[model samples]
Target: MVKDLKGVLAALDAQEPGSLLGLRETQWVDAKSGPYQLADHKAVEELTKDVAAFANGGGGVIVIGIATRPDHDEEVLAHIVGVDPAAVNVDQIRKLIRQRITPAPRGVRIGWSGADGERVLFIDVPAQAVDTLFVVPAPVGKPGSPRTDTVAVPMRDGDSTYWLPRSEIQQLLSAGVRALGMPTAQALIELVRHAVSEAGPGDGPRVGQGLPDREREMRVAYEQLAEAGLGQPAGEAWAQGSAALQDLHHERDGEPGWVLCLVVGCPPVVVAVPVWQAIVEAGRHAPGQSPLAAIGLPRPPAGTDTPWVIAADSRSVDVDGGSWGAGRMTCSGRGVWRWQPLPRFSLHQGRSAEIGTSGQTPALRLRAVVNLPWAEAGRLEISKPRRTLLEQQLPHSAVAGAVTMLSMRRGADLPAARWERGPFGNSARSVGYSCTIAGSHGGPALKASVRLALPTTMESTVVACADVLIEDAETWAAALGPGWETQLGFDEVQAVLLAAWETAAELLPDVVGDVAGLSWAAPPTTELRMTCEQPADNGVLPVLDEFVDLAPLGSNDGGPRSRMAVTIIAAPAMGRAERKSLLREALVRMAREFGYVDAEVDVV
Candidate 1:
């Protein structure tokens, strides 16, 4: 079933290949259409990841020359476009392992899967002992160049390849240093090599090649932190900081006035970077133009002009007199970062933040708060659309790292499940993708029922597409893991919104961009959610059972159009007007796809 990696690898892997014409990608299996491009350093790094991740986990199969379908609800394997065993360069694959991964993996076997012409390659990676973590070099500059100073620890969690978070990498190195009884300063220097990548990605570390500049940055930051006497206790530092902040005021035109200030202590600034990264991503609307610029202070690293603290010297309120970028970005996306001001109180929208960092960590508080117009409102505030955008950006940010510790006001109103200090995020994005970068990782399931319906009369082509969608929905539902037998209730609102959003993304992309520009640039946050309604009278087994891909295909040949529902009881009900509009749009879009262009949705 493992065919092409191109488009064939669409849905999740089934127990075996289905008639869907492709092998689904799953936690244990992956498919690719071509061999790794070893010439490109990034590709080589990727190849290292390809072999290492599988070896790191339960061990899995990487099938070369299989095409995959991209746009399906399930993991759809396309065709088995085999590789030439004669042309296979086994040494090249082996060479990448030596160049990148540390302590080369043991007993990785490569074999041919099919006969000639339809030949494909399969590399079986055996699981490794879990004592020490594996390391790999990171790609830099153009495709083939290697970053001498930086390396990443790649792991296969579920089906995704992820770099350990920078903090974790630091911890690992420090632990290694401790085991060897090395000095703390040397450990710190080793950690310094791993600089911040993209904002919010938790991209472990960018180790220096023992470069002097790298060591100097770490040394200076640590020295400043020591000078502040922050290592002894965070309370004292916070007290001093808060006391100093009270006297601060923004200069309006020429007059002094109250202004919001975003204060964060550095050295341990990495802790706060993710939160700030989310804010940056939420506000980012264009390239080379960042919303943070409006704040006037530098973006993160606590005091740098950019997002990296390693490359740029961090500005400090104590030293340089201002804040800066937090200096890390593992990945970038509209969803990677976010802003949501909970309803007033949670402390009534008043501003407060918890401090994080070690004495060994750097100290240099960063402060920059703008928005003079609504400065009195207190705390940061953003729209629901922005919230949605943040939810879509960091699907894999949580992988292999503990990069966030969400600190909220004590009086804030939040669900009990979220009261714990853990990764800062919600039920969207990764939950569905519950969902992560890895394929069929069986992550915690986040369920939102969606019911799709079809009218009694439609062209076979439309019916076919609709059927494919339904089957795809069912396939996705099936992938959610065991105990999914629960029946999906009707959610009219979700159905409509689902259709409308899908059609809008396809048809009016520009319009959506013009409107929700920040969110439009983000990846698709909503997954296809559909469920069929169960009959009140369960005794009767209908005649056309095989035809029904979903709960109940909308209508019979001559009966009224079938109805489907979608609902998320946990979600607060939307406004009445918006719900009605969504229903109308869903109908209109579905009808148009089914050849009803003039159809004006009136599905109140």
Candidate 2:
């Protein structure tokens, strides 16, 4: 949470004396005399060991812009500069600590020193609950003790000094291995359960009977509970209400000994009695045959008396019925039954009924048929109502009917479309027929094929309907042209241009000029340079004669449309009006080529 150099300096200034000691009783003297020195790997490792030791014993602080006096000698200040604040690499240092330490400590604060603009790393290692020990790959030796390199270091008691001990050093290296065999709360419970289960029945203390050692028995019981999925060592609380009741089992009829019993609930007398009776009867129906046996409730022998009894004093009425004897009533005595006389009738005696009327005969026998071509496409048709209704009301467009028929004919020879006709005044009232076409490359072709019989009256309604097909082929082609060309390649661009030219020639003759066969070849590299045709020279010349600098519009790499503007010198032969007109035409053509509809052109 500490912020800039000012805050860190303030915090350091507020700390108690002797707290700013460096790795080995190192103290921060005046920055002007000797600034903090950046410790090398050996120094850092030693510092970290002292830090861990300090944390394990009690919390301590390490100040970077500080030096310590050795051998009870006060420092004659030496100016050893600290690490450059701008290049401390604090994250790398933190990562090193995490990788080196076992059960890495967190919450260490690092900051910069304000006085000398140097790196100040503060490691606040809190007091660990358990003893914290670190294994150093190499040792920091005594002042003159041959420097044999100690493998591990411990924070010596009372002093902020780090000492490499000969005996306890091995213990640090083996700490991680020793941690593996230590019993976790859950593991301990499992061990106790295993011990209890191994004890023979009636051989050890009876179930719930106090063991010779109460603590040992409780430990065993706790272990058993854990084995039954009730133990949570990492501090998850057990469920209290109905779960507690369900978990508890006590002895009822067996020799004052406990056996696990799974109790569901205590229901009302009436509900319990009937269920109990049904269970008994079901068991009696098939001796020793009951499904509840899986949950430890098996059917007793047929002649065995039911041990479970519905308590007489228990509530017996059905809660849902609102009456004590409501469940006992029969359907015949209830209000649901009724009687009525049947009308004497037979299909032979009945006259032929018209679908929409009570008539003896109808003109047409109609049947409704529905066909779904694709899983998502379907059409419903009422054959009987063909003459009754002119057109079927569809959920989507009237075109849906046509779409349905076309899909039906996909990948198959076109079937004769079905239709119905109603009589008109002189001719019959004609209901138009339609079918949907589906599949690639079939819509327009089918539409063209069907449009032939538009005015002709055909006996087959289906054939007449086919003639009315309308295809949006040109629209679809125009929309897909550019995309198809882009997918195909630049060669296709010319093809697309030709196609567009032809389409425009047909659709907008006013804008397109008389056709001269289109031809194109890639322009030369010299042509890529910006040039303007000079009427006086009878040739093209670079637009800018002088050194002209260009910058991107809006300081971007390119303008809004990747466009740039250039001004050309007025030619001697061409009038200003002629030059302006030529520029306008060129700009318009370029805009069209670039697919811009609202490009602006200016003459300067």
Candidate 3:
């Protein structure tokens, strides 16, 4: 479960001092009953003992990076910073433990953990029925002590605690055998033989005569039990229990060999339990990691970067007469600015944009004559073009105040026209046109018109114009029919249109506001005279047979729009009943938006 070094460090930091219950320092143990020291030829034997002891004692942590020093303060120093580089072959460690330890510990998780890039192995030993004891050949110390005279056994009592001495160990082993149904000597012999066969040709000894044979049997049994899903193998379980027992024995005797041991049995078990218990504990613990715990949260991967544009300035114009006229108002100041795109367009309305700015800047207003088809919508006839100049340095707050005031005064009335600053730092402007009309449908037909207000000093400029048409609910329903129930509705249609607009904005480099100089041209002016005649094929319809005279504005020379006349005819399909039905539905919606009620639609 400890996935990385972060987890290991967190685990260590969370532990209470001296709470490493079932671990023992190999080098610190007394010679008689201890496993091999770090410098000894039988060092593997020491590792095997602690591993088994921890397993037998009810599971514990073993950290190999730090060692206890014999200083006056009884200080613990991080000595062997990590596993020796020469010992990179973990197979050797595995072999030593597998060959020397009894009922070899099951589910033993081992790996490196340290900032120094040194190896620090960990063994998670599970508790068993009785204590597991480790037997190692005793080393004779100087003078009177004879080298290799007798075997010494070391056992773990509690975390960092160990116990030794033949008599006490024999007593513990006897008790364990008695409690767990003692195996006969013949059973041991048979087990050793089985181990030899299973270990294959390179393995040594077929009897109790070799450590490999005994270890082989223990490992086999442990594997079998683990495979059966019975709380690890008996070997590890017994080792854990034995470790705890050894700790208790060491505490009473004050023996030197049994210095590293751990005790756990009461409530609030030490160490993070397995997944099942952890789940239960999680419910009991408060949200977030405790000061003593380490935790991690998952996060989504990073996404791709997206490009965006912001509007800087804006202006609006309203023409008041049917003739050509020009008016300007000085507006200037400074302010923070942000931009947003325009909303909903039916003509593949590409990206729309809006900008907000605040500062001591100048604001300009223009008046213009707008053409409409309905006689009820009268054209403005101005007596004279009037220009008003207002000079005032407005604060940043005034801009926001102006926006609020404008919004309030509108009172749900959709804006008829608005302006925006150019994309670049240029004296460019933009205009928006909107109109609303009553329809037979539940909602009103909303239409948007647009024009780019560019500086007209430059000629031959290409400007990209975008327009959006918002269809009424009735129009959409009529167009989509019942399929609207299964497909995306009006809202989805709007979203798709907005997406297309954004795509177009990205694709088209020469956007209207992007460049400067030339202004967007309006429809050219013209004077016309014409003659009409009845169509021979369709008696009810009339067509323009010829033009009497035509003239273009700005020049007397004949232009593309001058002296043009053409006849029109309805297609046979358009005269069909089904086609007429579709046409009526479409025309009804279009006519409603154009403010034409009960008006005849003549197609020629």
Candidate 4:
């Protein structure tokens, strides 16, 4: 709970060290064991990164000189070890914060935490506008070039910050969702436009030249003292007008870009875990050459439970394909893929073709979808009462009947989205939708696709309603599995709540303590309806009142139970290793409950 200066001080006063032990680093606050080394470029980059992440993630605090220890899956505050103030240079740190972060997150504060001269330094960042993403220097780019050294956009996820996957940047810019999430080419063009006027006659290209004209006509030498960001124009490589394309073609969703990328420092996003596993399991069609291995990712020994996350940058070297091959020739970006999670298991030639050029690696960025099923929120029509009911628990940002808030469409053709009415290709009795951002982090956002299966019987409602809620929980759990912890004002545990009541329920006080960062004295009120459908006027509208069961939502009330009557959308939360050792214990405990013998749960 040591997320603020008050908490830090309390810990210092009560215990010399470890008073705040075992406290996880929340989204709004993080602790560093020592002062930043200004002389090291990497250290300076990291310093700017920490500041940017806080600002990007709705602002928070970074406490330096606070020692921490890894406890379970999280790093907890372990000591009050202080840094020598004499060895710290507050002014330089402040300068880097300003110089490195684009637009320098508004209202940031830097100073000692307590007293006139305290042992710890606090870098406080205010929530930045999401309208524009912040950018920093990427490790690889055109060498010795100023302003053209390939800048990366850093985004904060939970308590950790990652380079905004290049694929996402394209989607945001294409959707015109934010200001700075531009395509690499457009980003470069924008940068050029922003700085060209200030350059001297011979310093760089003129404003009058078109991009192609500039690329074909200029040549300049590297400036050893050049800086990559603000106050500098495009570098010598760009000036020489070499044919390095901007490569940022903004697209909706994500693109299965031209080249196969290998992600560094992060795992590929799982668009649909089940679908992913199907493809992985399908690898048995041919042994000794797994799909993951074809992409250069390392797999654990056959029987070990270890996960094979692609966490390293293996994109720089030459790869020999087992079932695939190398074919580095084209640069037109045609075969280029932008968002295909499952690229055709084939050879990659794009990297070999660029060896002597950009020197940049195309890191793999995997992704997954987050739509929950709704019979058809966009197309279906309903009375005022039913619409209001849908609006309550599955609340959204738009006005009462907006499709974004409650998409009432037919069961089959969902989220493929035809915002306008006038389609008759297909239909289904059930439908489901998706999401990426955390719901509580920001609302009025695209949260989930609620599946409202058409036909409903007394028994099936339980499965339908529970399925959506279960997806809501599991999706969040998947989002924060390993290397994920709490974030201030964000309660990840709410996703895991199991409710028995139909109308509404208050989370038990004991459950409140399991929340992420901030604690609540009084639990919040949340409606937990086991059913979304209302019975006939003559029929008693079934409610799970203090106890008995029944369920689900939308126009249809009760019909004969068909496969169409129920739908289950689950987000795989744990890894394959989760099946180890806990199955018997779970089966033993779960079997005690009536009609629950085959319940399958993937737990760590």
Number of the top TM-score candidate: 4
Model 2: per-residue Cα lDDT at residue 397 = 25
CA lDDT of every candidate: 0.35, 0.29, 0.29, 0.35
Better of 2 and 4 by TM-score: 4
TM-score of 2: 0.23
Model 1 TM-score, all chains together: 0.28
Question: Which 10 consecutive positions of candidate 2 have the poorest summed lDDT?
Answer: 519-528
lDDT of 4 by residue, 1-604 (tens): 5555446433342222344455677777688988898887778777877787776787777778778788776777777677778889876785566556654454455545433333576665656556646666674433332253566777667657778787987786656523557776787677666556544444343321234343322212112112211122221211111222111111232321111111233221111222222222222112223333332222222353421321122221222222323211111223221111111111111211111112211111011111111211222223444433443434331111222212222111123222211111112333322232333333221232232232233211101211122223233334334343212110111121121111111111111122122111111111111221233356544222211111111112333221111111121121323321222232223222323334333321
TM-score of each: 0.28, 0.23, 0.28, 0.30
Ranking by TM-score: 4, 1, 3, 2
- Candidate 2 per-residue lDDT, tens place, 1-604, comes to 2332233333453332222333233222122223222255555566556555654555555555454454455342233345465555665565445434433443344444334443344554534435344444455443322122334555645443556566656565345435656556655566456435634342222222222223343334444443333211111111112211111112232211111211223220111222322222212211111211211121222353423222222222111111111111111222221111111111111111111122211111111111101100001122334323323322122223333333332323443333323121112222333333322444332221111010122211111111212133333233333333201121221222222222211211111122122110100000001112222244423222211122111122222332222211111113435533544443333433334345444411
For residues 1-604, write the lDDT of model 3, one tens digit per residue.
3433333333443231123322233322211121124445445545666666665555554665544554443343334344454555554565455435554444344444333443344443434334344444454443332233355555565235454766887776566556546476755565556645643353332211223323444344334323222221112222222122110001122221110112222111111122212222212111123211211111111241221111113221111111111211111243211111111111111111211112211111101111111110111111111100001111121222232232233242333322232222322232322233323353533222223322223321212222223333344333333443312232222232232222222211122322222111111111111112222345532221111111111122221221111111111111234333433343333333333344333420
Better of 1 and 4 by TM-score: 4
Count clashes in each candidate, considering only residues at least 3 apart in sequence or on different chains.
Answer: 87, 24, 70, 60
Off by over 4 Å in 2: 1-10, 13-41, 68-71, 74-83, 115-119, 140-151, 156-160, 169-604
Badly placed stretches (over 4 Å) of model 4 are 1-22, 114-118, 140-148, 177-604
lDDT (Cα) of model 2? 0.29
